[model samples]
Target: MLVTAFAANKTPPPSPTTTVNHPETRQIHLKPINRRRILTSLAATITPFFAPRLEVNYEESNLVTATFLPSADARGLFQMPPPRLSNRYFLVRAGESEYESMGIINTNPVAKTSMDNGLSKIGKIQTVKAALKLKEMGACDNNCWIWPSITQRAYQAAEIIAAINVVNRSNVVPEYSFLDARGLGAYEGRPLQSVSEIYASDVVSQNVKPPPISDGTPNESVADVFVRVTQLMSILETQYSEDTVIIVSPDSDNLTILQAGLVGLDLRRHSELYFEPGEVRYFDPSSIPKYKQPASALYKCLNPPSCT
Candidate 1:
């Protein structure tokens, strides 16, 4: 009964009959760089001029010289043991010049101790693996879902630029809309579909009887839904200069709620935007896990409790 009441009282869904018209183009202005000033300010052979100013401090260097010596049998006869061996031996030169003599030394237990404690090749590999895993996990923040769209657009633009490969262009034209959706129909003059209409018509129309009033509170208001749609549209526009057209059709009462919300957000006069409801996608927010804290926070709470 709740579902029926909500649906019946809801605003008429958006019209999906419309198709995308000619793509709109808006010019973004940018200030041209002053090449003359740049050339005048540029230094010719700047490195050469500053080369004398730079001083190399060879006197203060604390470089350590390591010399390898032949092991017993002198023909690679001994198997090199693991670094943990306290008395591990290696060949080294006894003195500084060509006059250096071959001598066996205990290798100063402290020196061997330092070399033993250094990261092993396996340890280095493990460190790299851990770093990569952390980076992958770090990308999944609250905005993770939005990244796919952003990345796709970026890749497409890159491809276009690479394909053209022209120089001295006055402006770079962007030729893709990232806000296109599958299914649903158009409202107003725009030719894109919305989620609400798709959900109501496809899902709600299936039941012969009206849905009962739900005991559970609605996850979001129609206006809230509209706002989210608009916000997503604005985000796309700001990021990629793409426009989003939303269409919703609701019953008179429910329409009032939607219109009020739209007016509150000052999007009522935007002709490119629409509100018709016959076709829209219905996303059930409840299906997704909603955590009080972000994924990072959750990780911190579990792994490094002190980080919080």
Candidate 2:
């Protein structure tokens, strides 16, 4: 009678497991808990996406004077408008230098140019490997240009890259303060770790310009660096197209910040894009993550297709 009553009950039995069968194959059983575990595992593996942060400062802003702009859509872009670029761009952080090996910080324009502060032996080898990689990638198959910082280590790396690739020696143009390492003010000649304080502040505000020295050394903020890098980008995008351009920097900060600006990232968090010494990254505008289109006032159009 008890079994008869159980059978008459309308309640359905809970499924302990479900069997999935492949045609002419073995049947695999999956428990409900197993399904939940699989879903949880997938969720753990997936990385959550974060929207680009825009922190604008009108005081440091300047107008972009270029007449021609690249055709890229500028919606949601910050610092500068979406660049119209036909040229392939590469960012190369200079190889380790003598000063770097010694754990010294040197951004003084005069002192950094000295030969002793130039690329160490390992640095030269690293630069040569990078050039070979570029050759393998056929980056210099056409007109290639290497724009390097005036700092000796970066210039040396540029020369090495030029020698190994198809680019001519003359094409290795030396850029001035624009590509220089971030200035650490009184922290100059201090230990490399001392600059962490400045970066900590940069995380708080992009407008935090470092105090200046009496000797005329640069004491700049991340925004100050952005201003110069934006100017450089204006020139490059305006003058070159259908060419390969390699920009070499003596330190990671310049290239990282430049990349941050290039991708319309918040300049204050530029350190998130830091490059290892001798690291090389190819820049592609189409591959960047997109955000909701922002108003044109969000950025200064460095080189706009139409400023209207």
The candidate scoring highest on lDDT is: 2
Error of 2 at 117 (Å): 2.2
Question: In model 2, how large is the Cα lDDT of residue 97?
Answer: 88
RMSD of each: 39.5, 24.3
Off by over 4 Å in 2: 1-79, 286-308
TM-score of each predicted structure versus truth: 0.15, 0.67
Tens digit of per-residue lDDT, candidate 1, span 219-243: 2323233433345334433443221
Superposed by TM-score, candidate 1 places the C-alpha of residue 43 at a distance from the truth, in angstroms, of: 35
Q: Whole-model Cα lDDT per candidate? A: 0.25, 0.74
What C-alpha root-mean-square deviation, in Å, does candidate 1 show against the real structure? 39.5
Q: In every candidate, how many clashes are there? A: 41, 3
